[model samples]
Structures are given as C-alpha cells and as structure tokens.
Target chain A: MVKTHIVKFVGTSNFKMFSNHMATIVRLAAQQQQQQKRGMATLKAISIRLKSVKNIQKITQSMKMVSAAKYNRAERDLKQARPLGVGTKEFYEQAEIQAPPEDEKKLVIAITSDRGLCGAVHTGVSRNIRDALLADPKERENTKIICVGEKSRAILSRLFANNILFVASEVGRKPPTFNDAAKVANEILNSGYSFGSGRIVYNRFKSVVSYAVDQLPLFDKNAVVSAPKLSVYDSLDENVIQSYLEFSLASLLFYSMKEGACSEQSSRMTAMDNASKNAGEMIDKLTLTFNRTRQAVITRELIEIISGAAALD
Target chain B: MSAWRQAGLNYINYSQIAARVVRQALKADLRSEALKRDEVNVKFTQWKDGKPASKYIVFILFYLVVL
Candidate 1:
C-alpha cells in the first residue's frame, strides 16, 4: 500500500510539471505574437508617412520646374523693358525740370505674391515698405498705398486697409500686362488727392535662389511740382498718356509676380529634400525590426524542437 | 542495466528542458533589444528637421510673399 502511494504521488507531480512547462511555452508564444503585431503596425505607419512624403516631394519638384520656367520668361521681359523704363524716367525728369509746382501726394505701390511657399519673400517686402513709410516724417494722412497681389492685400489690409486705395488681385497668378498696371496708375493719378511722388516696392529676382527687396522711385516729387513749363494735353492726347502710364505699371507688376513664383519653388524644394532623407532613415529602422523578429521566431522554434526530442528519448 | 539506462534518459531529458528554457529566455531578450533599436531609429528618422514640415511650408510661403 505504501509503494502504490509513492508511485501515484510521483506520477501526479510529473504531470503537474509537464503542464507548467506547456503553459510557459504557450505564454511565450503569445507574447512573441503580440510583439510581432506591434512591430508590423509600427512599420505600416512608417510606410504611410513615407508615401505622403514622397507625394509632397513630387509636388514640390513640379512647382520648382514651373517656377523656373516662369522666372526665365520674366527675366527676358524685364530685360526688354529695362531700356524703355530708363528712357521714360529720363524724359520725365527732363520734363519735370520745366513744370510748375502743384500739390502732390506720395503714392506707394507694394507688390507681393498671392501664394505662400517661397521663404522670406513676402515678409521681407512688407517689412521694407513699413520701414520706409515709418521713416518718412511726412504725415500718414498723405501716404496712399496701392497693393498688388492677394497676399499683399491681405497683409497690408490689416494695418493699412483703409489706406489701401486699390488692390490688384489679377496680377498674382499671371504677370500683369501694361494695361492692368496703367489702370492702377491712372487711379492713383486721378484719386483727387494730389501726390508728390510714386514708389514701387517689389522682389527683384536676382537668381534662381536669390531675391532682393527693391524700392524704386517712379516719379520725383520736386521735379513734377517745380517744373516751369507743363505739357498741356487735350482730352484725346491725355487719354494716350494714360495708356502709356498703365503699360509701365503693368511691366513692374509682371516682374514682381514672376520673381515671387520663383522664390516659392526654391524654398519648397529645400523642404522636400529634408523630408526624403528622413524617410530613408525610417525604412532602415523598420527593416531591422523585421529581421530581428524573424530571427527570434527561428530561435524559439529550434529550442522547442531540441527539448521535445530529448523528452522523447 | 535497465534501471541505469532509464536514469540516464531522465537526466538527459531534464538537461534538454533546462537548455530549452534558457534559449527561449535569451531569444526574448534579443527580440526586446531589437525592438528598442528599431524604435530609436524610427525616431531619429522622423525628426530630420526641428520643426514640422507643415510649419516649414508656411514659413517658406510667408518668406516668398513678404520678403
């Protein structure tokens, strides 16, 4: 009876041990499976992010190409207009010398781009204009602003909305023709408030990557008011001068628009380049995790097989 | 002779079981370390720039328009 009891006790203990060992194996397997799931989820998220980054890169690249093309055309146009603009300025200066004095109000036409993407282009232009306006001791009441581009309107409207006499939005997407610019110029000239001078603020595209905030005086105050002899024009001839004035303004608007577009593209390109580099690093990490998980699975299997074979023997 | 052979088989089984458990533990540790390394690599990759891409886009646009 004692011998039977000892045999039964040992059998029960052995069975319990086997059950515990199986339980441990099951638990380890479950844990590994969970880890794999988590790793896979992480990898999926990374891949999604990478795809989005790639899309952004493509868009930025296209924008860069478009901007480059626009910049080339704009550069050509600017070159063509340079000689004409200089000649006109010289003629105006000579005419102003002989013109009579009159009440003149200063008009500032500030040009900015509609879209935001180019780094520092719009902000720089706005800051330059603001500084110029503030530095002039001339009373704020005498200063009038003509904003070109939607972004310029939006920004300037906040501070000088009331002072904004006119906004030209059409110039943002395409280069404003001479006719469009002349309309703005004529409006300023006819606004009943006599202005002494006109100034244009715009980004002068120096290169594909470089731009400058250029402030140019369109008309001199003293010359326009102090000239002794004024060229008197009948209504019909005055209409012709109006057209020419508009043409000049359009040329300036066109230049600003093209330069802004170029700057936007270059900035986007740099941003996308950084994103691509980051995606590459993420892929490397995910690949490592995948490899390690696979190796761990194999090691676990090998251990289980070796233990089972020994138990069979 | 039969009793000795049985005892030897029991001992070998126990040793194999112990080795299997140790190997499983080692595998677990290796897997955990690999996961950690992967996480670190992902983090390093994600934050290439200090600022988010969206913010950078806004900054660039503002620069182009205002500058």
Candidate 2:
C-alpha cells in the first residue's frame, strides 16, 4: 500500500510538469502574435504621420506662394507711397514741430495687423512699445495706447490692458487706402484722449527679408502752432491748420499702414518658406523611415514563412 | 467755410469724397486700380462674458460717390 501511494504522487508530479510546459508554449505563441500586430500598427502609424506631413507641406507651400504675390503688390504700392511719406515728414522736419517736454500726456499708435503666423512681425512692434513703457514708468502712467491691428492689441493687453484705447480690426485684409487712414485718424481725433504728444510705431519695410521698427513723431495743435518756422509762412489761418493737420495725419497713417502691410507680407513669405522647407525635410526623413519599416515588415514575414516551411519539412 | 464743413461733413467724410473724386479723375487704367482701394469692409463686435455677442449690429455708413 505504501509503494502504490508513492507511485501515485510521482505520476501527479509528471502530469503537472507537462501542463506547465504547455502553458508556456501557449504564452509564447500569444506574445509572438502580439509582436506581429505591433509591427503592423507601427507601419500604419508611420503611414498616417507621413500622409499628414505631406498635407502640411502642401499648405505651407501654398501659403508661401500667396505671400509672394501679395509681397510683390505691396512692394509696388510702397514705391508710390514712399514719396508721400517723405514729403509729409519733410514738412514736419522743416517746421521743427516738436512737443514740449513739460507735456506729460502721450499717445502711442501701434501698427500691426489682424493676421498672425508671420514670425515676429507683430511682436517686434509690441516689444518696442513695451521697452519704451518699461524704461519710463512715468510715461506708462501718462500714455494711451491705440492698437492699429489686433495682433499688437493681443500682446499688449496682457499687461497694459487699461492703457489700450481701442483695437482696429478688418485691416490688412486688403491694400490700405487713404479713406481707411482718414477713418482711423478721425477716430483718434474724436477719441478726446487729448494727448500732448504721440508717436506712430510701425515696422518699416527695408527689404524682402528685413524690417526695422520705426517711429513717426506726432504733434498736437499747440506744438504745430508754437513751431518757430510757423512764423515764416504768412496767413496760415486756423482752418488751414486744421485741414493740414487732418490731411497730414491721414497721409502718415496711410503710409505707415502700407509699410506695415508690406513688411507683414514679406515676413509671412519668409516664415512660410521656412515652414515648407522644414516640412520637406521631415517628409524626406519620414519617407525613408516608412519605406525601411515596410521593407522590414515584408522581410520579417518572408523569413517567418520560410522558417515555418523549413520546420514543416 | 470749407465745402465739407458747410455740408456738415467731418474731415473723414470730406476726405472720402475728395478721394472718390480723385479716383474718378484718374486715367482709365489707374482709375480702376485706385478705385479698388475705396472699398471698405468693416466689422465690429462687442464682447460679453468672455464671448462675442450673438447678435450682429450692422451699421451702414453712407458714402456719396460722385459719378
């Protein structure tokens, strides 16, 4: 009876070992199947990424082309508008119209645009104002900001929310006009901010690839009247002065808007061009990776089939 | 009195009228190009509760375009 019990225990131990071995085999088979699925999933992911990258490349390329055309038109319009700016500025310089130092109230007209993705065009203008405001705390207290475009407003509103008077939108959608300039100047005139001095800060279009922040000096009626050169001209009456002031303001605004628009378009062109180039590089790398993975998947399957056939034989 | 003030028009309105006349006075090809700048399309929105208000208030400004 003792011999029979010992044999029964040994038989049960052998059966347990066989079952454990079978379980390990099944686990191995499941892991291999999972690995194959993972390989296919990776291939699908790479394909999807490659497709999306291609689409992005196409969009950037189109944007670059559109900006190029707009830049050309802006450059042409800028040429005609350049003389107008020079003439207006020359009058101010000759008249020696300057704001008195004692005048504390100030206005800053920041020129940018509604659109973005132009790469630092709007930020450059906003940064200039921020620097000025930071340099003089007193100026910050006395100054009123008029944002000509939505982009500059968005940037300055974070800290100087109260300083902003208003934001002008629906601009930069098309070529700026004298009428548009007049409308903006009209609003400024009527806003009753009554600033003693002002400056129009804008991005001056230097070339297709470069731009510089520039400021055009603004003067109130008092400064214009107090100018020493005002004595040189005879019979310059109040109405004439008013008309001239209004016209000059409009002219300057028009010129600055044109310059800002040109700079915006050129910068957008450069930004889009760079984006397209980067997308192209990514596409090349992704295509190489995608092809390599696809080839590897095929090779892996072929190897599996061949090895399986060998095992069968 | 200036014709603009006499007509009860501000400088902006006067300028628009003057610009239209100038555009009309331009030579054929230049006139077409210059007139294109006369078009003004503006939209104004009032925000409430951190969102743009649902109703749009359209204010149509009249411009006297000289033929």
Candidate 3:
C-alpha cells in the first residue's frame, strides 16, 4: 500500500510537469501572435507576399500546361523514332560483337537538354557517369566524354575537365530528327578522336512516373571485326563495316535523343505540375494567415476605440 | 525517381527493337535509308533562336527564294 502510494505520487508529479510544459508553450505562442499584431507594416508585408505568391502560382500552372502539350508531341516523336533505331541495335546483339576490355579507351555520350527545372534530368545522367568513372580505375583511363546538351556539358565540363571531347547543344527541344543525330555523329567522326567502345548515356522514360540512366553500347571496329560469329554477317569489305558503324551510331543517337526528349518533356510536365500544386498550398496557407492577422488588427482597433470612449465618459 | 533504381533486367531499348522489326512493313532498307528523310515526307519550318528581328525574316525569305 505504501509503495502504491509512492508510485501514484510520482505519476502525478510527472503529469504536472508535462502540463506545465504545455502551458509554457501556449504562453510563448500567445506572445508570438501578439508580436505579429504590430499594426500596418506586417499587414502590408503579408499582402505583398500574398500577391506575389498568387502570381507565381499562375505562372507555374501555365508552364505546366505548356509542358503537358509539348510532352504529347514528344511522345509521338519518340514512338516514330524507335523503329528507325531497332535494326542497328539488333545487328550488334546478333553478331555478339566483342566489347573492348574495360581498361581500353571508352567514349560516353551524355544526352540532356539546355534548360532545367525538370527535376535533375540532366544531372542524374552526368553525375551517375562521373561517379561510375571515379569508382573504376580502368574506366578512368582514357574515358572520353561527349556531352550532347548544354546543361550536361556545363556540369561534366566542370567535373571531367579535359575528358570532354565534344559538346553538342540545341538538342532535345524539338521532336528529335534523324538529320540532327547524323550531323552530330558525322561531326564527331570527323573530329578524329576515337574510342574502343562507345555508349549513349541518356534518360530512359519507362512511364510517366519513371526514368533511368541508360547506356546503348556501340562497339568499336576492332571489337566488331573480331566478333566470334562475325562470319554469319557475310559482309564484303572494311569500308562497309566502317559505314555501318557510322550509320548505326547516327540511328542510335537519333533514337536516344528522341527518348531523351520524351523523358524531358514528361518530366518537365510533372515537375511543373508539382510546383503549381505546392504554390497553391502555400497560397492557401498564406491567405489564412493574412486573414487572421487582419482580424487581429480590426479587433485591436475596436478595443482601442471602446477604451478611449470609456475614458472620455 | 532515379533511373538506375527503376531499371529492370528485362529492359531493352524499345526504339531500337521497333526499328528493327518495321523495315519490311515500310518497304525500305534499314541501313542507308534509316536516317534519311524522303523528299515527300520532308518539311521546312522557319524558326529563329530567340525573337527574330524584321530584317531576319526578310533575309530568310530572300535566302529561300535564292534556293
């Protein structure tokens, strides 16, 4: 009975402590609210902020709509470009073309866009490549990078320094064209820097909600020429093989660009949509706060008038 | 979401796969003509990199006529 009484007394003291803490919190909150009642300046400031927030919401909502529209056309272009890219990819797979040893020279083409605000679409690919290269000693040796978008170029240039061989921009905006890819590949080919094996690094759009940093491999001539089953191809000459490499490079780049475009557009659409939603929520919260402040001001004014009248009486 | 986290082993480059299968249906060779735009399907669009000045349009028109 004595022990039970002791436990009860301790419990009550704990409860009292908690209640006291809550009361102090309430008092602090009341003090903060009273401070916020500083007459006109706070009210004016809130109104200005409210107006700006509303305007920002409007702009983000419109940007979301524009991206949604562009996303549809980009999806269509991606669909159209796919069939054009399939054959060359198949040839490499079926031929079981050898890939040069990882230690050998490698080329990675990063596909991204110039603009941003699409939730790290460009940085995801570039950073992934950078980290991967840093992790692998073999990969770090003679791994040249070609950046296909301005954002990726800017980022990877800072990270990779001399490793960036070519930078291609003005891509991923329009429905990607085969002509553009061909031109870029030709330009790189003419630039005279070569690689053992090449890969196109890009954002692969799996669905409206998902994307992946993907690599489409392009093996070099030595690797392709020495494929264990290359005899099955029955091709004639070295020139055919070289042209085949060029053409496949172009086709794959074209298709990768289209896919990147689709991913970028859809990503932008979703990112903008989320931004607009967040802005809307912020506006709602700000409006409620503004109304509360206004009410406090009015009540304070009424109280002042009544007290002044009482004094006169 | 990150792409690497979402990637599955079954994943393939769908565009390249589709391109391979559509050649016979389109009645065209996939190699030389893969990236070529046929004359009939070609289009020309006039676009300026920011806002085009009035002189730029006139110059473009003159260049088009010359072509």
Predicted model with the maximum DockQ: 2
Report the number of the highest-TM-score candidate: 2
Error of 3 at A295 (Å): 0.3
Per-residue lDDT of model 3, residues A63-85, tens digit only = 78888898888887788788766
In order, the first chain's TM-score in every candidate is 0.63, 0.85, 0.85
lDDT of 3 at A173: 53
C-alpha DockQ for predicted model 3? 0.04
Superposed model 1: Cα runs more than 4 Å off: A1-41, A92-104, A135-138, A220-222, A225-313, B1-67
Instruction: Compare candidates 2 and 3 on DockQ and give the better one.
Output: 2
Q: Is the docking of candidate 1 incorrect, acceptable, medium or high quality?
A: incorrect
List TM-scores for all candidates, in order: 0.53, 0.80, 0.72
TM-score of chain A of 3: 0.85
The digit string of per-residue lDDT tens for model 1 on A145-209 reads 77666666667666655566666555546544433444445455544655556678877656655
Tens digit per residue, CA lDDT, model 2, B1-67: 7877888666667878877898899999899888788886433333332333324322222222322
lDDT tens digits by residue: candidate 2, A71-185: 9999999999988777888888988888988898999999888888687889999999999998999999899888887888789888687787766778888878767777788
Evaluate model 2 with DockQ and give the value.
Answer: 0.21
The DockQ-derived docking category for candidate 2 is: incorrect
lDDT of 3 at A179: 60
TM-score of chain B of 3: 0.23
Off by over 4 Å in 2: A1-40, A232-235, B1-3, B6-12, B22-34, B42-67
Instruction: State the DockQ, from 0 to 1, for candidate 1.
Output: 0.00
Model 1 agreement with the true structure over B1-67: per-residue lDDT tens digits: 3353346432223333454455456667676653332211001001111222345677799999998
